[model samples]
Every structure is written in C-alpha cells, then in structure tokens.
Target: MDYIIKNEKLKLIYEPGKGAWTYHLRIPNSEHIEGKWGEIKVSGSIDDYKLESRNLALTKEGDKILSINNEIRTAINKKGGEGSNFNAYSQCSINCNFSLSVAIL
Candidate 1:
C-alpha cells in the first residue's frame, strides 16, 4: 500500500512495498516531482572505494514525517584500501510542513 503525508504546502506519497520509493512530491502551485526509480539514491565511497545502498528500512513520525534508513554493504574493491571493510548506515528524514525540511544523517 502507498503511504501519504501532507501539510499546508506539501504532500508526499511513499511506496513502502517498492523499497520505500517516493511516488510523488507535490507542492502547492508547482509541478510535482515524480520518482521512477525511487527518489533517494545515495552513493559514495568507502575507504576511497565506491559503495552503494543495499537495503532500506522506513519509519513514520506522527502525520507529517517519514524516516528512511539505508544499510550499505558489499564494498567495491579498489586501489588504496584504508583499513577493513565495514557496514554503513544512513538515515533520511522527510518532513512535510509549512516550512519543509529534509535531513540526511
């Protein structure tokens, strides 16, 4: 099922069944920002090696916020290994309000 949260100025539709993908981002008097392959895509390097998201977990905060936590593993081997391979966790918080805010931790 799709999850939804909205406020005075914004609305968000999230598809938890599809890896918690963002289905639609709506703003008043503006065109909607749609997502085809999920809205949040996180990519970075671990020990100078490329790393990518492997899994995700979602949590809802009240009626206007959604929290998505990403777990990353499967290190991509590259030159210059810093130390040892490890797992990484990232949290993305989406808030819908008059003053909207998005935070990645």
Candidate 2:
C-alpha cells in the first residue's frame, strides 16, 4: 500500500515495498536543494525517513534529519529500522527553511 503526509509546508508520498519506503517530497526551493520533488528513504516506516543522495549529500555523517510539521523526525546514528531524524530537499544540512502548499481544494 501507499501513504501520504502533508502539512502547511511540505508534502510526502510514501511508496512501499522492496523492504524500504521511498518518500517523494515536494517543497519550496531551499538554500541547499531545488525543492520541487525529491526522493528519500526509510528502512521500515515513513515516520523516520532520510533524504540520502550522492547527488546532494545533506551531510557527511549520513544520519541527516528532517522535521515534518513538527510531528515526525529522524534520529542520529539511526540503527536497524527505526529513528527520529530525516532529510529532505537539501539532504540535511541547513536548518528548516522550507514551505509547502495544498494541491487539492
């Protein structure tokens, strides 16, 4: 199955299967990435997703994070299949400086 998460500043579509969840993030452009549409991953749940891409390495630590609606998050040294930290448009470098809008009325 698939899931979707959105807020006043971002939209996330979770695609399941393959032992991992791929999150498609849509947000406004930020200092690090051109926040149009980017893909992130989580080992098990969407609640703890990470935006990791060699094209736009958010950090060297790899354990980058993203905060969604101040609700969900990823964690540092995320081991196994759970965490509290995540990455988005800009991987996971700059502070949260992004926005999103509702597509449907």
Best by lDDT: 2
Task: Tell me the TM-score of model 2.
Answer: 0.21
Model 2, backbone clash pairs (residues 3+ apart or across chains), number: 10
Alpha-carbon TM-score of each model against the true structure: 0.21, 0.21
Poorly placed runs, candidate 2 (over 4 Å): 1-7, 18-21, 31-105
lDDT of 2: 0.30
Among all windows of ten consecutive residues in candidate 1, which has the lowest summed lDDT? 96-105
Residue range 1-105, candidate 2, lDDT tens digits: 122222333334344541222433332332343222233322222334333341221323332323232123333323233323232232323333332222211
Off by over 4 Å in 1: 1-37, 52-57, 61-105
**Which residue pairs in candidate 2 collide?**
9-100, 65-86, 66-86, 73-84, 73-85, 74-84, 74-85, 74-86, 75-84, 75-85
Kindly state the number of residue pairs that clash in model 1. 0
